[model samples]
Target: MEFMEVIRKRRSIRKFKPEPVPDELIMELLEAARLAPSGTNLQPWRFIIIKSEEKRRELLGHTVNFVVTAPVVIACCVDLNTYKQHKPQRIKELTRAGAFSGVDLNFNDGDKYWKQRGALNANEIREYVSINCAVAVQQLVLRATDLGLGTCWVMMFDQDSVKKILGLGADIDVLALIPVGYADQDPAPRPRLPVRELLIKELK
Candidate 1:
């Protein structure tokens, strides 16, 4: 599908057929996410592919019960440690690649331009990591749609409980739940704000 057609056809699929999505296709979706751009290549996104009925049932306790009906529910996660561990090296790498041309690389004074990840509070750090992870999630969903799979981003869940259910450590945080499978319904496009209303300002 053309990119715009994929965007237009994409819907928040709630109902899913019993047909299983192939593992090869799932890998393609993951590859799309892997190629998503990240902040200074921090690449904090990690995923838990929940394919078993038992685990889906367990997650249904926290997320919408309908989510369990799908054959796969991906637990999209953000590894906070990625930023903490790779910040310096990524900055150096970016410097070498001329991402910040004409700027001197500094090991002291926290590099002045690069904000210190360590300075962020617990909530700030999570939000920071989640933003990067969301980019990857969007790419994955778009890829899934192009491959004739259905998906819904489920966020109205008990994050702490879901985290425990997935056996993720403190450094990893579940950002969203994506249930992927064959579509059981062809949903109408949800309402969207007009482009005029969406733009704060338009310059010639």
Candidate 2:
């Protein structure tokens, strides 16, 4: 599908058919995410894909009915271990690459902006960590749309339970739950702000 058409047609699909998403197509979607940009190239997204019937059923209430019904559910996660492991290298890279051609990069910009919360707590760091995963999630959904699959980005799940269910270690955090499958209903386009209203200013 054309890029714009794919973007326009993508919806937060809730109801899904019973067919499973093909592995080949799933890899293609993940490939889109693998190419997403990240701060200091610190790609921290970790995907935990759930396809087993028992697992999905177990996640039903913790997540939503969609998890039980959709053929696939992906747990989008952020790896604190990866961040810690690569921190030194990423700081060097970010500082060396800099913000732009002229602007110097303060690699510790994260420190400055976030440290005000007293000792740079996990909550503050979570904001930056989630960006990498969020970008990947966007890519996954767009690719899913192009493949004629439907997806819903879910965040209302019990986070701790999801972590336990996935057997994730302390180094990982659940960022989102995406249920993917064939759409059962054709939802109408949602309302949106007009182009002019959305734009702050348009360059000539």
Candidate 3:
């Protein structure tokens, strides 16, 4: 499918059919996410694919019961260490890969970075992980849509409860719970703000 069409066709589907999504297709979806770009190419995201009926029931407990009806649920996560704990290593690797163009040290990891890190109290780590993981999540979502699958990126849930349910450690955090499967219903697209209103004029 065309890229723009895929983006336009993608929707947040809440209801899904009982049919099961093939394991291969699921793997392909993850592959798309794996190819997403990340800060210093650290690739700090991990995923949990929930497909078993019993586990799905457990997941339903974390969010609204209705969403778990999908054949699969992916727990998108980010490793906190991807930034704070491994900044130097990632920067070194990025330089080797010719990705860390010094345009960013003086562009990669410089005195200003360490100073900002000290000032931010490590919050910069969250910022990096969040952006990287979000990019990956969107990649997965778009790939799933391209495969004729429906997905709902769920965020409004008890994060702590979900962590406990999945036995996740503090080192990782869930960004979204994407329920993927065949759409049970296809409603009209929701309203969107006008492009002119959303796009602002460039500053001279």
Candidate 4:
């Protein structure tokens, strides 16, 4: 499928068929996520593919809105250790290098930034790492759409429950849960803000 077509046609699929998704296609979707760009190319994302019915049911119980009818649920995780724990020195270097050029790094009189930097606990860093994982998640969703598969991005779940469900180490953080499979219903396009309302153009 064409890129634009995939983007336009992609919808948040809530209903799915019971048909099984092949391992090769799942790998392809993972590959798309693997290739997504990351801050400093850190690539901190990890995916846990859940296919067992019991585990899927348990996951659904945690996030009732999650589309577990799909054959697969991919739990996206972010590894905080992957990027040296977001130190102030590194942030200074990144700022000096213009790594965040055209972006604002300030956060509430700098307290928010320092608070994030000082995050030594898993919960604190989990929020930080989840931001990076979101980029990879977008890639996965788009690639799944291109592959003629449907997907739903689920976030309303008990984090601890998910951690226990996947038996993930305390160091790893779950960012998002995505269920992928063949669609059972064709959903209409969701409305979006008009470009005129959403975009602000500055003509020089």
Residue 57 of model 2 has an lDDT of: 89
Better of 2 and 3 by TM-score: 3
lDDT score of residue 118 within candidate 1: 43
Clashes of 4: 0
lDDT of 1 by residue, 1-204 (tens): 999999999999999999998999999999999999988788999999999998889876688987899999988999989877988899788777767765345433344565642466778778888999999999999999999999999898998899999998889999889999999999999999999999999788
Question: Looking at candidate 3, what is the lDDT of residue 3?
Answer: 100
* Candidate 3 Cα outliers beyond 4 Å, as residue runs: 100-105, 108-122
Q: What is the lDDT of residue 29 in candidate 4?
A: 93
Higher-ranked by lDDT: 3 or 4: 3
**Which pairs clash inside model 3?**
104-107, 105-108
lDDT of 2 by residue, 74-185 (tens): 8889997666677667756665765323423433464433234344357656777797789988998999999999998899899889899899988899999999899998
Identify the candidate with maximal lDDT: 1
TM-score of each: 0.93, 0.85, 0.89, 0.80
Question: Over all chains combined, what TM-score does candidate 2 have?
Answer: 0.85
Every candidate's lDDT: 0.88, 0.82, 0.84, 0.81
lDDT of 3 at 117: 54
Candidate 2 residue pairs that clash: none
- List, residue by residue over 1-204, the lDDT tens digit for candidate 4: 988999998999988889999999999999999998765466789999999878788876788554567789999888878756545556576667766555355442233465665645665556656777898999999999999999988888888988998898867878888999998889899889998997688688
